[model samples]
Target chain A: MKNIIQNKSKDLQNEIDNYLKCITDSSLLFFEGAREAYRGDYDDAENRYRDISELERRADEHLKAIQYKLYAYNIAPDSRADIFELLDGLDDIVDRAKKNIFQICVEKPVIPDCMKDDFIAITAASVDAVDILIQGVRSFFEDVNSLEGYIKNVYLYEKKADALEEKIKRSIFQSTVVEELARKFQLRYYVEKIAMLSDLAENLAKKMLMYKIKRII
Target chain B: MILKLFYLSSGLFMGWSLGANDAANIFGTAVGTKMVRFTTAAIISGVFILLGALLSGAGTTGTLGALGAIKALPGAFIVSLTAALTIMSMTKAGLPVSTSQAIVGSILGWNFFAGATTDYTVLYRIAGAWLFTPILAALFSVGLYFLFKAILENIKIHLFSLDWIIKLSLILAGAFGAYSLGMNNIANVVGVFMSVSPFVDIQVGDYFVLSSLQQLLFFGGASIAIGVITYSKNVMMTIGSGIYRLSPVTALIVVLSSSLVLFLFASENLQAGLIALGLPAIPLVPVSQSQGVVGAISGIGIAKGGGNINTRLLGKIVVGWLLTPLCAGILSYISLFIMQNVFLQKVFI
Candidate 1:
């Protein structure tokens, strides 16, 4: 409420917005890499992963700046830790995006023609989950009452991503038509990693809710 | 003229402390929120306070004069100095202090020393004002909040424009609050000096002239301006964020309500009107601006939801409020005794 406190929050909010933009870009880049991998374009997938790594590094820089500012600024007790916790959790979403995309580029596993759509679908769902999460995070600072609705949408997309992961993993293991056992396991791992990104987003939403409670109550 | 000015020093000091401390209530939120610069607030407040002191500071001094008279020059000096010292000490200790109560206590001490009978009815009325001023101000704020909230909801104003409006409104209300503060509480600063004023009517070019009381108010106003320029920021920060987080709208309401209470109590015509209409007169009492602001803020907190307030800090302030008069009274009494015996000064007429 105080002007001095709000002035401090302005720089902090700017830092958060920068980090969040990078996270959003990384999520979209992760989805693009998954599509290239499904098309048997390893070179394109590698380029996208490199792009995601750059975004991740930029997001990390912003996160560091924010942490430093929080240390420097004599912020309000209600907002200081709660906002940092929210930023930390959001930053991890970018980390997961980077890690998931890198795994796809490195493994270069064989994908069945039939399973390609499902892989792309899982990637789409994961990115959607993070986008909804971005909106939920924005709502935390703006309209707190609207955050629950965005989080519910995040959970819905997460569940869809999980169901697809389970279905695809089971088919890869069961069919005798699949040749290498090691390759089969790797396929499951890659699919599971994509699903993990959504899970991380879901986790962030819940942790954000926790921090919001700690702040107001 | 020099002796008259020297005698006015104590009142000037009390005025300085009042500006340093009470300016927080009027402009703290605006300054702390960074919505207004401290210099901007100080300038607006100082000019308006000077205007209000010149125009409206006389009436309240009449009631204070009735209480103990403090008719001798030495007694007035000692009483005002004791009140000023009490405020400074409490402020340094990081406790909320009231200029009004300290002045009353010092006057009471002087009353005892000068062998004047205390006017019990005037004292009771002042005591009554202290009891009800904050409560009444809080009610005014609560009612104003809901009414303003409803009116604001209907206007689909842009956020930027709304921010500008609120900023302008806060400055305007702060200026109004400054005027009301000068009008009501200036008496607390210089009321005792009125009794022993040395200047008679003076004429310069037959058109421009000044009374002794006018000189006192002018000197008092200048001291408060100096306090605002030099010392208000720390107190403003404390009251702005320390009490609770006040929004722009909430800050405006709190200030308006505080001014409302001061104005209501300060107006004799309004009091007489109420009495004529079969209603009890609201006692004309000098109130602490901080107390009124705190009460309004807490009132809004209750109106919204009730659980987040810091009860311990509030408890300390409550204790300080209760002890303010007692401390000032004892300090004044002892100081007056020492001035009479140790300094071998004439303290009473």
Candidate 2:
């Protein structure tokens, strides 16, 4: 029974790592699609976003599977709580991405407008943050030494995303045209999604750190 | 004492209705400005109100009994319940009216039913209080706007830094308003019943303390808190977007000023304070919550070059203020008469 519990814990960690990796890849691809839309490569952008959305859906499915496994194993209440929050956060990011893509496909506002560059920068920074989040969680889960640097780096990236978003909002308000207004509103939504995604990643990293302290991970 | 039980139960219902309907007055601007999300605003408002009621809401619990014309505990209970039912029905019909006036009107109806013992002087004072609450709210809004403008000019700080500071201030102000609502208005919603009946005796070591009134205020507040969180989104949305444009500073100032007015008037000696301040003897009843908010908004409007005030909306709200009590009194009186003649006389009596 002890050996089985240990093995199940190891499997849970592996599943988490794979989920973060997939999220990072799709996030980068999503940003690339956003950049393409700015460059007037509408077809390429649409295709890339569609691809990212499909991957995000699969990632969510895997996350749900892991949650089911954890429940089946009668995971400690705290560990179960952490998993639920992490999965929910992960799913929220993907859902935001999917929604943004839908808005792009349907609304099709003029590309590379006032908010375009800021949106790209925020998403790129968010992707970087989520990448470090995976590393931080992995280190903490494995009881690897020197996890502070990874955690601090994730905080720094999230802060950077926040600053970028602020600057973008200020610029959007400065412009007065109707088209600029539409672009600004859309850009704000996407930037907020990226920031929120990073925030969730940070929460997961914190939970991992706590789990390590409790020796539950 | 037995009659007081019905009064207490009715007051609890009134409190629930008050929380459900009037919370929007405190939270609408913040939610409308997108300063805070509606869900966060509601939850925070709910939790804080529970805290406020449990702690500081005692002052306003017996406000109507002290402020209005209801003759006895049974009369007060009937008045409160009738007013509450009228307000709820009106709310369902999409007219956002005042719970304060409803309670006052229902008490007046009860007085009329029992004959001329209702204090006309107190009723007049209460009417005057309604008239003044909005005016004071507007004055405070205007005053705060001027004060803010002078400070901004004198400070000579970076605009970006100022924006961040103002946003933070708005958040804090919204939270404070939530707390104050819990402390002050939560009583308006549930306090009547607290004074009406008795609760189970609670044992403290060797001594047993008996409550003369039901402790249903807590439950009523909870119910209203739930209603506000669940159904108040639409009202907040309507007010937030449709009302006048407000800068972050202006919004914060208006809320702060209005909340202060509510807090001050909601004091234990609010009646005496009004007299001391040489304000007309406003009956200490729950006046119109919407009126106070409108007055504050208008104050901000006057401060921000006067174009921001939507006169049409203000007029409509005033109409609601006028109609709510009269309708409650007439409807409740008729309903009570029917119940007395056809229902209660045949059943309980």
Candidate 3:
């Protein structure tokens, strides 16, 4: 009976590790895809978008499997709901990453050379926020005390993303880099969409803190 | 033979109530948190409790014998019956009661009625043990809580692996707690009948033998096991989830600490070892398992910075501690009087 529970727990742990890996893979893909779009490499950007979309699908499947096993095996019965919520929050990071990359591929916004670096910078910050958030989640499971540092880094990256996003929007609308007002609005929408990833990460970090507190015996 | 069985019924009833109520103190949090299944807890606790009773129940029973030594079967019956009745009534009134305390009071009543001198030294030792049980449990828990915390912080175990460890630990601790309960509290259920026990010694093999006292303990232990199997689930749930919500890890500490405390008081070998070392031996007397659990919980609460101590509940338990024995003693005295006079029974000889 003990071996059975240990084996089941090991299997569940592998599934969760795979799920988190999918999110990390998607974040890397998003970073690459946004860079491709900025560089006018539309083919590469499209391929990255397709890969992230597939990863998102796989992550969803993993989430479903994890949920089923959690209930079926009755692991951590007291913290089941909290565990599910934390995992669901992580899935959102990948979901947002997929949508961001897909939007970049479809809209094909023309970027000025001057503001291109700023846009990539925002993407990098958002990706950093998400990467740190994943690390925070892992720390939550392994070492709760170390999780606080990861959470703090996530907040820092999110703040950096927010600032870079503001800088880019201010440059786009205030400077005469783009002549069309509608194009500026489109660029700003994309900026906000990318920045939303960091915002999602920040929210999840707050929740992870609460979960950590509860998990502490 | 029928009359002898009839006289044993009250002791069986006391054992049943002990099983129903005290099993929760061992397995409540584990089952309540769903870390362990109720059936699993019941089986492990029942088996271990019976084994402990059969093997080590003589120590505390000896102490009770020293206290009063009821010589007649009918007298033992009345004492056990009054103790059981007092426990049931106190439980129904939702007061925290201890079978150990009740049985002691009942024995004292018997001592008074039979004109047998109460052994004041033995009585003081029993009272001292009751006071020490919870405090010792609390001290053990506080130390264990910090130790576990330090180990967890230093180790790099995965959350799932940690969960598995805690689940397994709870089971092991519950078993130890059940064993200690049987060794310590079985006396409360059947100790009064030791002088009047009907079983005779039996040799099963050239090397294996069972004494009459062992057989008596086995019967009492079986009654407790039946109570655990049949009626302890609701009480387990109430203790597990209702009183104070303990995390699985904290629950493990609580069980281990309380079990150690009970084992300390009940183990004759340990007492002998201490005596050999020229140290004072802990009295082998039954103590409240519920109080031990409560103390362990409080120790953890204090370890966590002492925010929610629930002093009101502690006050009520203290009140119950005082009132239960008094009620049992009074009831035992009255019941013995009627048994001797109206029923024409020889309560004492």
Question: Which candidate's lDDT is highest?
Answer: 3
Q: Compared with the true structure, what per-residue lDDT tens digits does model 1 show for residues B276-304? A: 99998777677777777766776676666
For all candidates, the clash counts are: 5, 11, 0
For residues A101-216, what per-residue lDDT tens digits would candidate 2 score against the true structure?
A: 65666666563455566777887787788778767755554433556789888889888988997887676666564245666687666667667767866776776666545421
Of the pair 2 and 3, which is ahead by lDDT? 3
Q: In candidate 3, how many Å is residue A19 off?
A: 1.2
- Candidate 1 chain A weakest ten by summed lDDT: A1-10
Per-residue lDDT tens digits for candidate 3, residues B272-326, read 9999999998899999998888888878878888886767767877898789889
DockQ preference between candidates 1 and 3, better one = 3
- Count backbone clashes in candidate 2: 11
- The weakest ten consecutive residues by lDDT in model 1 chain B span B153-162
Candidate 1, superposed: residue stretches over 4 Å from native:
A1-33, A41-106, A113-117, A134-147, A162-185, A203-217, B29-37, B88-95, B144-173, B198-208, B239-256, B267-281, B308-322, B340-346
Candidate 1 lDDT over A1-217, as tens digits, reads 2443244556776877788888888899888888988898889989988898888888889988988976665443334566778778877777777787777777777789888889889889989999999988877766665678998999999999999999898889987656799889888888888898899899888887786554331
User: For model 1, what is the error of residue B6's alpha carbon versus the real structure, in angstroms, after optimal superposition?
Assistant: 2.4
Docking class of 3: medium
Pairs that collide, model 3: none
Error in Å for residue B171 of model 2:
3.7
Candidate 3 docks with a DockQ of 0.58
* Chain A TM-score of candidate 2 vs. true chain A: 0.78
* Cα lDDT listed for each candidate: 0.79, 0.65, 0.90
Residue B308 lDDT (model 2): 74
Give one digit per residue, the lDDT tens place, for model 2 in B62-128: 6655644333445455666788888878777656577777776776665566554666666676676
Best by DockQ: 3
